[model samples]
Target: MKFAVDPWDPTYGTSLGTELGESAAQVALDVELPSSEWQPIDPDPWVVPPDAVLFVDGVRRVDAQVWVDDGGAEAAPALCASYAAGVVCCCKDGAHLLTADVRRGLFTTADAADDVRTTAGTYRATRTAPHPDVAPAQLLSLALQRELADTELAAAAAARGGHDSVHGGADDLLVIDGPLRGRQHLPRAIGFVKSHRSDYLPPQLGGVVAALRTGQRTPVFRLGSSWERHTWYLRLPCRPGAPWAGVVRVECSADLSAGEAVGHAARSQATLPRFASTEYKDSRAPQNLYPIAGLERELRRRLGEPNLLYRALRRAAAA
Candidate 1:
């Protein structure tokens, strides 16, 4: 039997089916699925002058059971366990782990020193309401996740500085797994978007996205919304499935000149394809680069043994 996963949608009883049908129809009419018509880019030394490429991503998980006063029935006290980690690597050399930040026992509600760890990490207390409707436990979990992301970015930046000091200001490129909104000033840094949640391009430009081939990339263009950045699409090498299967969007700092942006595009086209993961190596395959995959595993490991942390939290909360 094929297992299917469904999102927690309140509209499932109402507009979910209608929304899906409309979305499918819109994709058929407006968007063209990716094809193998992209411009092939040769690996050029001038394009990728960086000594290393740093891949940065964050992970967070909440253990509501950590302090389940009433067996996690309703409005129970909870804690968010979060951590951030970074990895830096080059094509020739493997990955080097960076210092990670871990925060545990972040309280879900406003309480005065409810637990030992919570009291130690005094900033873990949630004062303001995140949302009027969301449950307290969920809100605290969301807040912890946001905090984790910020910490990851900071760790990534610190790692870059640390690497520079060791390697004598080597020109290293940083590839963050999400949008580079707050990190606009990071030199030689680019955001790597894996999923296609929204159509950033117009109908005319949809063909350009569709034409991307393995190890090929689209032309650089300005992506403007709340934040602006020079972005391009690159299809990583992978076992063929669908047109857009291995496509990843790369975006660089908008503060750069046009030439610099184009340079970043070229660097991404050359560098990213080298790190593309195969189906055998990763479940996510090409979009989840090798360094990134390893980095994620390392981060989770650094987050401490899950069972141990949970038990400790439970015991501390009971005290």
Candidate 2:
């Protein structure tokens, strides 16, 4: 599964007209999937072949988790920072106890020279924040929104002549981390995906509907505020019947998420495209900022386990 997007596509939900509070209220009710017809995915998170592909339908980031750690000195924020180590992480689902030795832990990508390295923590830590400026809950929400936005923005920017030709290549799954909603951004994204139903997404969202038609891998999601909360997003294979269309949500919440560590990787073994990343490492610029090419090479090299780059994830996950 591949995602070819259109950066020019009007960014909805960001502008006015709809009150932010009301918009959230509108999404309050869970868009129910006709369970009788749509089959949810297996809650037990599994691994996809390293070569798997993902077509991101759309991403709507509700920065609600920020509130979970609104107070810089809040308990949730501290806990979020501690768990950001990539093990024993918490979310809305409960707890996801990750074992560094068992899971990929983090993903590193270095530039050609391997001078500057960037390691995006693979497991729970990727979503945690230890600084007072960014509380854990707030950062987690932002991470979800930003990562998905990177994929969407990248595909859109990479499209050619109004047609997105990116991830059309046949692969296993195209994972877009989020939930499903009919209206708002979710519905609009689905519309685009259905239009591009060919190898990649059709003019609109052909790829999205196709994923629904052909059962997609149950997308693994972490509960933003609490790692303990585990929600599974599975597009029923062929959608079983009409009306109960593409994308199904499976609630696999538990008292703790410690055991399901191995299944929490962002992208396993597949070719990782360049993502507009968070301000994880880049704090100052010019005087202190790393060069663009240098950053890329270092980022890739450090994160690329096959090479010798700074192993931030290994250290963090173990912490």
Candidate 3:
């Protein structure tokens, strides 16, 4: 099944040639200027900045409008099915630090004894109850994970398809908010803890991964905002030994470099066939996306990739 993998917060609010404030921004996908819409392929031997890992596209300017079509005849549904999932692997606990510290340990006070413990630098109160540092960090760790129950792999393995659908029309597509562990993200983040730490994947991923591999299906990873606000950067798949594999950067938050994005797309398009032939296949490299069509047009104008406009025109013709 043809799959399109996109991260939840791939757009960068910061600016061009600049990075985000979070340390995770270190892993952002670099953008470049867009290519000419008149030509299909970008200029050969395209020049790139020496430090640029991911280049921007050619079209640095953009304008787009949604074209609504209401046909009388029955339109064909997606040839296959679609599904979506969002996973919150980590949580943010900075807000509740003070309230947690003020009520540390058992004192049998009038109010519910403050069982919450917070970490150092978690808040700005500059006051603490002389508790251990581990307590606060542990407390702060529950922000993203607050919703996920069945914490043990053995307790129940995972919660069944609780809330996996979010896409507009996804009958044949099954999308996950995080990696399926069939890829490289987890192994790198938590390390291979024996058989890689999948205890955090919440079981749904386990069943999905089993389906993808057994059916020779391609699964899409849609890294979400829960991870975005903290993690900042995400991964993309590259050809094994392709020099850029395991490459990651902050999501889409940098200035546009002249042809980097398109070059990378071209590279991906050309590399797909060869990459498809390899056993070490993956689709989790870095990604650049804009939630707002205007932002996408501006960025695409800068980088020169106008797949949006072309797709629109094609639809217009079929109409």
Candidate 4:
């Protein structure tokens, strides 16, 4: 088969370099960046309570059609539909014992017909119904899936119980797969960031982050954004080359006092590395914890037979 390919000219490399250089320069604008000073902490200082921690993650897939029409002469909108699913896994004695709950749903752009308009910095109001075509529908589908997944985790956190109480504290930790975002306020919850966007520290400090040894973590530092949190980087045991080869960022609510924040940091340094996946088990091993990888597989499996679901959606639209 003949394929057209975009030619890589000399200008391409220069353009790419300029973009990356600007990105690195932009890091300085993040006033919340941590100081260059930091110290390494040992992971052995803490003990994880049995069956008191939960890990949450989600998965989604979209099925679309080119041209869809109602049963009669009525015009049919393009169908962009998907299944969004999430799972909550409870940890016990350094192992994920069982799935506490599974949440999933089928969503489509057609359902956005009655959505009201709103003006917000982060939210763009959809005044008109979404187009049935793949592009428009798929965008709406993805947004819906993300919302559902976050909602599921929030519900599970509520049911599992909060971190501590005045009468007696609940010794549970909620480890979310990605940034806590809107869910940061959840009690005893923390966000696990697998990918790094920009440097959150100066070069010298970042060097310390890169040099972190297995089971070692950087000193906890406060990060301010639209939300506030204490953040640190930890290294997992893995075959490594670069400084950040096995490093991952962990974030906890800044609402905690200094002592409490340090305690949570210690618990994470000890608990997370134990769940790190081997290179043979995952392409993104070490950073992608084994329990999270397993939970992702389980959620995708619960999405059901894709072909069957696709045909059902088509049949329903036709009818």
TM-score of each: 0.78, 0.23, 0.19, 0.71
Query: What local lDDT score does residue 74 receive in model 1, on the 0 to 100 scale?
Result: 52
| Candidate 4: tens digits of C-alpha lDDT, residues 1-319 | 6543211123323101222121222122122323544556677554664346677776656554433332445433443333333434454444442333333333333433322111211111222245546476556565665665565565555545532332154466778888877767777778998766656666566677767889898888777756777877888887756556677788887777766777777888767887788867776776778878887787677666667766655564464
Tens digits of per-residue lDDT for model 1, 15-54 = 1122222112122111112423334444455664567888
RMSD of each: 7.1, 21.1, 25.4, 9.3
TM-score of model 1 (CA atoms): 0.78
Which segments of model 4 are wrong by more than 4 Å? 1-36, 44-51, 65-80, 84-142, 162-170
lDDT of 3 by residue, 1-319 (tens): 6543332222432111132123221212222211111112222334322111111111111112212222424321110001111122111211110000010121111122122222211111111222344453333222212211112111111111221122222111111112222212211111011011212222333332222211121121122332431111112332333221222222111122224324333333222221111122212222222111222233333322246434533453364
The best candidate by lDDT is 1
* Cand. 2 TM to true fold: 0.23
Error of 1 at 2 (Å): 20
Query: Which candidate, 2 or 4, would have the higher TM-score against the true structure?
Result: 4
For residue 66, what is the lDDT in candidate 1? 41
Determine which window of 10 residues in candidate 1 has minimal summed lDDT: 23-32
- Please estimate how well model 3 matches the true structure, expressed as its whole-model Cα lDDT: 0.21
lDDT of each: 0.65, 0.27, 0.21, 0.59
Tens digits of per-residue lDDT, candidate 2, 1-319, equal: 6543222113332111122121111111121222223332332334444332222322231211211223345324211111100112122343222211111221111111111123533333233334568645555555554454444444422321122233243233223323322111221111111111112111232233334433343333333331233333333222133322333333323332433411332222111112112223422111111222232243233223432222442343245
Relative to the true structure, candidate 4 reaches a TM of 0.71
